[model samples]
Target: MLRFALFVLFGSVFAGCASIQPYYTPNPDIAANEVEDYEGPLDAELVAGTNIAQRIARREAADYAFIGSAAFTGAADEDWTSAMVRLGRTLKTEKIDYFTWYAGTDTATGMTSVPVMRTSFGTVWGPDGPRTVPVTMLDTDWLPYSYTVPRYEYRVLYYKKRKEPLPMGIRYEWPGEELGRRIGTRKALEITLVVPGRTGWKNDLFDGDVILAVNGRTPTKELMRQFCRAPAGGKLKIWRDGQIVEKTISADPSEGK
Candidate 1:
């Protein structure tokens, strides 16, 4: 609810004005994590009631989630086409996988118009010669006459989508260091076996544990070769026993200077 008023610039005169609420409002119902686009096609159905609660109940019974809803006042001047245009915009913007709409009749009361009068005096020449006359005029101002604004409230649209399945809680570790040959030092790799618990395997690798990076890289085949062939040592960041550890790698001894 708001009120408006106006004041004359550099003058003591002030005029009061009325502020009316808008006839339509857009109401959307959606959750942050529930947002997702439909894979196939989307559609809408215009239902014929205004009971939001009942509409919600029906949606729940059908295992649907709400997307959005809106109420429109069916003003005499607002035809079906215009109303549908607004509804279409809403439906498209909401992009709900499914839609249900409701419509009904109601009224709104408010000021429709305001009438103001203006007067002026002037001298005019007529058949009887020059004459002084006072002219009065009524200004057709549509700003302030208050009245009952009978607005027929109709159509309640419901938007919804299929309920999403709950995500599984299972978390599976990799179970083996299959890429160790490319991601680990050559000596460590030579002593290592991809299979768990190989006899005399000096290299260490546990389930879900592996060397992730070398010199801030993922240690791909090319990157590992470059790091190994370099003359200076580079840091090796490894994930072991639920923690990250750093080690230094010396230039490959076989790369004789």
Candidate 2:
């Protein structure tokens, strides 16, 4: 009986010791060699709660936050509707979640690298073009003090329109290569392949392998956004087992699955 009592006491003490031990999770802020959209796991306590606008505000300035632009596609003409449509799709995919005007030079000869933001909204291709406004005039419901502020500053809105087809095609890359410039190239784009269960092909996609391309296109920030449009059930061209293998992969938003 005394031996039984002593064992019980020891077990209780051991359980208490285990209960008090600290828990550890990987730090999301650590600069990973590979590029990722979010700083940490989407499931992380802080990240899961953050909204799209908040993410943009954290990365860029108040002015830059509101406005988003992708380089204009197709030939420029009196008709700018095509550009607007393309801009809308890009904005939707980015979850910019709001709308605004498109900005560019009159000729449209030189365009910005990713996209260009305009101070105000105006007609796409009317005789006078879209009306323009100041960035300071813009307002955001997400902003904490937008109501109480003395003078509000402006932000740029993304505008994609329907335009005629261009002779040359263009593409964009994301999580942007800009990240590669910050962290070393060795850590670039090496993430565990998250896909739906139990197919012979998916099992072959072991973690730590690098993605060489998507349908023979270089993985760019813009290209990734396009890829997200058809995210699930797409063919992934990856380098594995000392060779390149094309595998079909699917991941839904619900599971991050």
Every candidate's lDDT: 0.41, 0.34
What lDDT tens digits, residue by residue, belong to model 2 across residues 1-257? 01111011234444433322212222232223322232211110112332544444332321122234332222223223323333333233222222223343333233224334446644454577666544524333322221221221112223111121110111111223654444333222443322233222233555445556765676654454345454364665665545667766564443222
Best model number under TM-score = 1
Q: Residues 1-257, candidate 1, lDDT per residue (tens digit)?
A: 12122111222211111111223444333454444434323334444444554555455334354555444444444443233334434344322222223244344445555567878898999999998888888877654343433355444343445334211100112223554434444222121112222211113333344556668775454455445445665676766655567766544333331
User: Model 1: residues >4 Å from true position, as ranges?
Assistant: 1-29, 38-49, 80-150, 163-257
Candidate 2 deviant stretches above 4 angstroms: 1-188, 192-204, 228-232, 250-257
lDDT score for residue 36 of model 1: 45
Could you tally the backbone clashes for each prediction? 16, 32
lDDT of 2 at 13: 41
